[model samples]
Target: MTATDDKTVVREYFNATGFDRWQRIYGDGEVNKVQLDIRKGHQQTVDTLMGWLEADGNLAGLSCCDAGCGVGSLTIPLAQAGAQVYASDISAKMVEEARQRAEVALEGKNLPTFEVKDLEELAGRYHTVICLDVLIHYPQDKVQGMISHLGSLAESRLIMSFAPKTLFYSALKKVGEFFPGPSKTTRAYLHREADIVKALEAEGWRIERRTLTKTQFYFSRMLEAVKDQ
Candidate 1:
């Protein structure tokens, strides 16, 4: 599918059923075993990313863009940690939900600016750009352009996560196709790590840190990339 076509599908899904499903997974709520596992796995990724960010020193006054800041999961924490955060997502519902959550979490304090924006529409430079678990929506053919666009917007670092393509994971994903669930509603694309690294290198970035989070139902390869000096 074309980039526009891909964006439309993502916006539609997250604005509807995807919003509800992820809200539950990211929230402190009752969920099925699979979803609970997914929640744990996602939190691990977020924690790993936070560690990498904080290790660079104080987040105070740092500018950040949470490229797919679904429901303020990372946005709220970053704001609380004193980062100037601008968060965006393709789903209006997700953005609205994140805004509401941020309002409550920040208690009228430092709150992130939230926008409903497709990744391609994002502009301006930031100290760091984070796009987590969002790349699963993009196929290999379109990944390079997206990576370059994101890289251009980050003055210092770009952190991203994607479903890893491998024989084991690919087999698992194929098996998942047989089960009836939300997984069937929209296409999920897995990407090779080497391809991701190549894309980052092409944009003049180098991997600084990396981690893999996996569970029975969730998998993500998260990495931090720094601008090559």
Candidate 2:
């Protein structure tokens, strides 16, 4: 399929029931069960990301974008930390749920604006732009274009996460495909670290740090990169 076609399928799939079901499941305190063995290091991952943001110190008054900001998991925290965040998702239901969660999570505090949008429609540059766990929806060949678009949307830094590629990881992904309870979308792509780095390099992005979170179901790798001006 062409990149446009793949994006359309991804957009449709996320809008259907996948995103809402995931939000319902994870938002209801089932993250531990759904994630199984990886629960122990969840806070560490968040802490590490927060540490990265804090290191720059420029995050205090920066405008940020959380692309594919599912259920406000990362969006709420960024807003609470004082970033002017704009969060968006392909799923309208997911956006609504995220808005509700932000209302409760932020309470009287300033919260990020949430909207229904896909990565392709995202515009403008941000001090920091985050797209986590969203790359799986794109095919491998199109990841470079997507990464380029994401990199262009960031003025200084771009943070992203993807399912790591390895022989064992591929096996696990295949297993998930077979035993899926919900997410049954075809053509989800798992990415290799080297390939991802190459994609970033093509768009003049320099990787500053990367974190690998290992789990039974999947392995997630988070990266922080700076655009070469």
Candidate 3:
């Protein structure tokens, strides 16, 4: 499907049942074994990224963008860390949830600007731009364009996470596609790490850090890239 087509599917899914399903998974709520594992894996990705940011310097006054921020999982922490965060998601419902959650999580602290926008529509330069777990919906061809767009908005850093394509995971994904579930409404795309790196390099960014988070059902490759100076 085209990027626009994928965006439609993603927006529709997230604006409806996708919001409910993810809110539960990202929250301290009851979930099945697979979901619980996914939650853990997702948290590990956030924590790892947070650690890397903290090591760079104090987050105070640092400008960042949480592209496709859902329920403010990373947005909340970034705000609490005193970063100036602008979080956006394709789904209005997800953006609303993220704003509400940020309000409660920040406790009168400054809230990040939340907007309903697709990745292509995102504008402005940030010290760091993060697009986490949001690229699974688009194929590699579309993802290359997305990487370039997002890279242009980051002055110094860009972080992204996607389902990594491997022989084992590719087979598993194909098998999973045969059985559709409530949360499987959108197409999930797996990307080769080398391909992603090449795309980033093409945009004048170089990978600085990389890690993989995996569980029984969840797998993501998290990468941090900085402008090649």
Write down the lDDT of every candidate, Cα atoms only.
0.88, 0.78, 0.89
lDDT of 1 by residue, 1-229 (tens): 6777877877888888888988888999999887788889888888888887788786988999999999888998899889999999989999999999999999989889899898999999998999999898898999999999999899989999999999998988898831226543667899999999999998889898998998777889998999755
Query: Per-residue lDDT of 28-136 in model 3, one digit per residue for the tens?
Result: 9899777788889899999999999999886889999999998899999999989999999999998998898888888878889999998989999999999999888
Query: Which ten-residue region of model 1 has the weakest summed lDDT?
Result: 177-186
Which scores better on lDDT, 1 or 3? 3
Cand. 2 TM to true fold: 0.87
Better model by lDDT, 2 or 3?
3
What's model 3's lDDT at 122?
97
Candidate 2 per-residue lDDT over residues 1-229, each given as its tens digit: 7877876776676677666556654454655454433433444555678788878787677899999987777788888888899999988878888899888988958888888998989998788898887888787877888898988889888888887788977886677731245665647688898999999987888999999876444467899998666
Ranking by lDDT: 3, 1, 2
lDDT of 2: 0.78
The superposed Cα distance between candidate 3 and the true structure at residue 9, in angstroms, equals 1.0
Number of backbone-clashing residue pairs for each candidate, in the order shown: 0, 0, 0
How much does each candidate deviate from the true structure in C-alpha RMSD? 1.6, 2.6, 1.6
Ranking by TM-score: 3, 1, 2
Q: Is candidate 2 or candidate 3 better by TM-score?
A: 3
